[model samples]
Target: MIPRHFKLLLLGAAICAPIFSSAQKIKAPLPNWQNLDLKADGQFGISTEKAYNELLKGKKHVPVVVAVLDAGVDIKHEDLKKIMWVNPKETAANTTDDDKNGYADDVHGWSFLGSAKGSIQYDNLELVRQIRLGQAKFADPKNIAPTDKEAYKAYQKMVAELQGKIDKAKESSNNMLNVALKFNSMVSKMGSRNPSKKQFADYSPEDPAETQLQKIALENWGTGDFNNFMEEEIYGAMKHYREQLDYHFNINFDSRDTVGDNYADVNERNYGTGDAAGPAPDHGSHVAGIIAAVRDNDLGIKGVADDVAIMSVRTVPNGDERDKDVANAIRYAAANGAKVINMSFGKGYSSNKTAVDDAVKFAMSKDVLIVHSAGNDGKDNDKEPGFPNKFYEDKSGEAAAWIEIGASGYIDDETLAAPFSNYGKNTVDVYAPGVKINSTMPGSKYKEQDGTSMSAPVVSGLAALIRSYYPKLTALQVKEILMKSAVKVDHKVTVKNGDGKRKVLFSDICQTGGIVNAYEALKLAATY
Candidate 1:
């Protein structure tokens, strides 16, 4: 589970009333449009196919390892199994630390959210954790020490924000329940669980109550099969809101005991199990697929890089990821020979940012490139930077091998930038095809997701592609080539600015002011 705002953006649809049915027929874009070129296919994409055909044709490339640091990954998925990184020293399920790297049976990768018993599926948000700790430390706000004044002030603000979130979650959950009940009643009256749009429109009520339900359905849903709208969307939103109250915003909720690690020890790295594919592998699997899912398999969608191995490093949970786990995951990946790392998860706060920064420096020292999502808050990253970013907490220096990616759509007009994608002229490095990106899911399934989560992997895949063909180029050089070789978009594009949309030149919002192009980057890589 990402932040609520990020999850909503990844869903690619609003969960509020007057919800539009995904079942509504609409003309779909060309299959694998993210790899198609704008000039050749009339779709705004990264031109991956063109790169493979023209630039990388018949090229003997080394296998580049891309570490996917997210919730988890489906290592057994048809499209991903063949390309998963296997630990050469550690054997699978033998309960032995063959590699002697403090991890046992890490055949694929490691799961920082797991333990010898099981894995954590959900956890409290960072805000909740902060409040929980603050309330204990500063029980008497009036007797705060002079040095604790600022900490107490921030705690008070967090308390207020947590209250607001609780209220909103309760209201949304109630609304969903009411809407679900009404839809169920309407279905009961119709004597059909799966009624067509015409059937719903032609419904005749036998009583005033039923008539009122019919009117509400028509007003909220408009048209389409009510079952899918109610079951998938409504119930899903209801569950999300319920989780927000039960886990995310709940100060008493603590799942750290399951992991059996010292909660206060930010430097502890010898904990967790080797189950990289935890209880929830959907998000990570999709991200891995976007990066490298066996391109020539012809089973699912083709990934951006053909000769790459995906290393699963499970760090994120259903709620906000802890900075300690993120730090450990980065170190683990960098030490395990990952040339590129994709971090598709982020939060607004970090409890131990220094640990993460140190880990980032370690990765940098190892010449590994990290690609991170710019976030889905639609806010300027310059104003509200995401956690575990390139900037070190102490501001000594920034990571040279970092790429911040924003989401873009498959369009060349004003809608090119994804409305939910976060951007900044000095923060976001480039944009990538993210809207309606189809990728591999858990259980050998596939899904089309939207968000900067999807976009970051696009850039990561490109980085892996460059690293595969030109292993001599440094991570910083690859980052520069990717940014400088982006396809410049001079026209203005519509973007979300608070509650309203605004049109701005693409160059004004991001450093490159353009979307990433694989063809151009590969061409530049050859020159390097």
Candidate 2:
């Protein structure tokens, strides 16, 4: 699946490296800024502290289950172990289906990306998969049948887009190589020594290009060793681009056999393993911590919701997620007792939209609230629709219990909207604090990350908070209260639009024209 945060990291290293070279150093935002209020703490947080102090001081609450449908989670994490969902009927690590629910020993949740043998970490993008499946039938225009005209046209478009991506990857790879070479040459000319910032500033360059390169090295690399920077950051990015060409965009690359399921079947539910913590649980673990890490444990950062259970449904891999796995994951969560599902992963294309739509409908029928990240492409989602959206493909209706979120920074001026967040006035419901958010990571550690991936969990945690306190309200009612009680931004904010930045009113980009405020939402929930 496409983790929005990871995609932004690749973009920064690949496409925006040049701009970053000339950029000034930015001060890191204060930790736990996402819970602080703007008026009370001078940060554009969700006012969670205010809600806890003034609204929910002595309130009794039930535990709400929030299903994280993404790249798996570390279920045994120190900060997350006690808050994880446990199957009451099934036992952990047993080879039998104790609960009689078709899955064997699904203690926490299920992993649709794994099998009895191992798990699938990397796979081709959905676009590449489409091209690979259709090449034999639509490779040549002369062999196209009249019934396949539209399909053939779409196939051609996929080819063109794939080629464009390949070309860009190659170009970025070449740029990074050139930069590495320049750094090496500068080092050689300076008697083969990794210089400090003062040394770099004092050294004279023979040419203007070398001078520019030296300035970039000083500003971006700081006093770090040039060799390590080249190996870890520069060459590492080059290797990533190479992988994109060889694996992500490669039509011949397929990893579905690892899952050992019938690839053509859209409704196969008996496959996959019971291990929710797959090979990589970094992204999912961070997301879970943001939602339901134990509060006041004095061990790690507190979560948005105090009383909640995190259910891990691993459907995402290193690449784009399949529609079948996503649909099954949603069904699994809904069939169980997950009142809210947080989807922090998305892609641009959906080969099987009907399956996902039906699963979403199933979740809705079960009174489950689904929250999705808008995306990190910095484009208007209304123009370029993202998958797992609220709209159904059959032109029937939209989901009433869905909340699409965009990322907002801690500042309220030109930097209010996160530069990488995708926005749409009719698509994105609200914004949340996502910039420099510190949370639990794998290996009992913690780190800061930024994206709409981070933003969705903020809203999800808020939703769980509301559901825990107001158990009588339906999922649709919670969605309404969150949207209606959001903190509206009347001033203009600067947002990224493709290659440039533009100033627009917050209302012009999101449906609520504001950020999600927990205090206001809980206050509004009390009335309901």
Candidate 3:
């Protein structure tokens, strides 16, 4: 699954362009809105500031370790460096496995997608791979056995969906490239790379062909500022579509060769290198910052909790994360004393869900909380399954420690729910502020992102807060406290349903019927 943050940004670029003068600086909508109290500011925030001020004031807290399972975390981030979970038993820069945990020099954490050569950046979806592998079985239904009837049916559905995606990708790629070429040709005629709409329009047209091209460019690129839109937006979209058509949908490309792991084996662990920070670190860095960016640094925004040790477990890549890596990541988090695990990546298919489920159970047994994103597909999660979910296809319960989260927004109006967030009355547990969330990025920088990926870590940070202060509470108890203490909304809200808006009760989107409140949860934890 692609990181939800980038998807939101790209989606925004397609619809709107920022119109502002260089002289007039636009003030950012408060960077710490997610930490504000709803009653005080009329925003759908988690009241993190209130929690620290009232409940956690002068209280002693234990240091809780939180594991971030995503692409990769920048361990050396300025605000995050000091809070990284260091392996006390393992020696850094040593060739030997000092701790004897079947990993070498894993000082910060481990990477299941890394090897001596490099990290994997692209892979075909499991559904695409399955279709390629079972082409014979799908080609003729009569060849399938009675017991294999159900599997054959599943293959048919997967093939249909894959074909649709491929067709859509090809069409979009062709359309974007054509428009970009026309736009670039106009820019060349104007003799400037960053051409204003007025400049292009005011210029004399050479022929009927030039007039037609300029008309199309003006309609798509807008009649205002055109800074970075051509390169970052148009070119970016083209690159994504090209990659989708070439790599993600290509059955011939095997991404597993980079990791040197057997694709068929799920039990194999301890096969990857110790490069916790994989090829891409932006996604995981943002996630880590949301969970535990240092407070009082006066440089960037403070995290939900001040006292926490972040454990980095790199597993996710540019494409769908493999099941074997996910299972091992969970086991590593549980075994290494990580009390809370934040899993912000998800896909539509699962190859070996049982292995992942068993690992989830193992983490639950160790009393580790798992906070997962409900996904960014803007659909009901109760109907559609996302991998690493709370339950398998059979509906057997996985873990009590698990918390499924949908994305919320700072605005408290009809658009409270994030337009792209996936929600479900039965599947999702609670909602949290996720839109325009400012957090850490790579190179010790900060950026605002939007996604349930951001929302999941907000809850993970709250889980770490509870576990830190209320050390006696089990993972399940912490989950119950968080859900029971959420701030319930009383009115219905309008959410994006495909291209149109639909009015839905806030309670109908999630089981909690409320936005998570860190202050309320901590207050409830004090009673127990």
RMSD of each: 3.6, 3.0, 4.9
State the displacement of the C-alpha of residue 457, model 3, in Å, after optimal TM-score superposition: 0.4
- Name the runs in model 3 displaced over 4 angstroms: 2-28, 136-150, 178-192, 195-231, 392-396, 496-499
Tell me the tens digit of each residue's lDDT in model 3 across 1-528.
744435524433443223311222222346589999878866678999988888888898999999999888898889899889998999997867998999898899988886887887677777777888778666777677898888887887888888898997787777667657766777787898887878977877675545655554455453236655565457767787777778788777777888888867888887887787888788999999999999988777789888899889988877788888899999999998999999999998888888999899899889899999999888888788788788754577567889999998887877788888999999999999888898998889887788999999999999999999889999999999999999998888877677788999999999999999999999999899
Local accuracy of candidate 1 as per-residue lDDT tens digits, 253-301:
9998999999799978999998989998988999999998888877999
Alpha carbon RMSD to native, model 2: 3.0
Total residue pair clashes for candidate 1: 1
**Global CA lDDT computed for model 1:** 0.86
lDDT of each: 0.86, 0.87, 0.83
Question: After best superposition, candidate 2 residue 168: deviation in angstroms?
Answer: 1.2
Report the number of the highest-TM-score candidate: 1
**TM-score per model over all chains:** 0.92, 0.91, 0.88
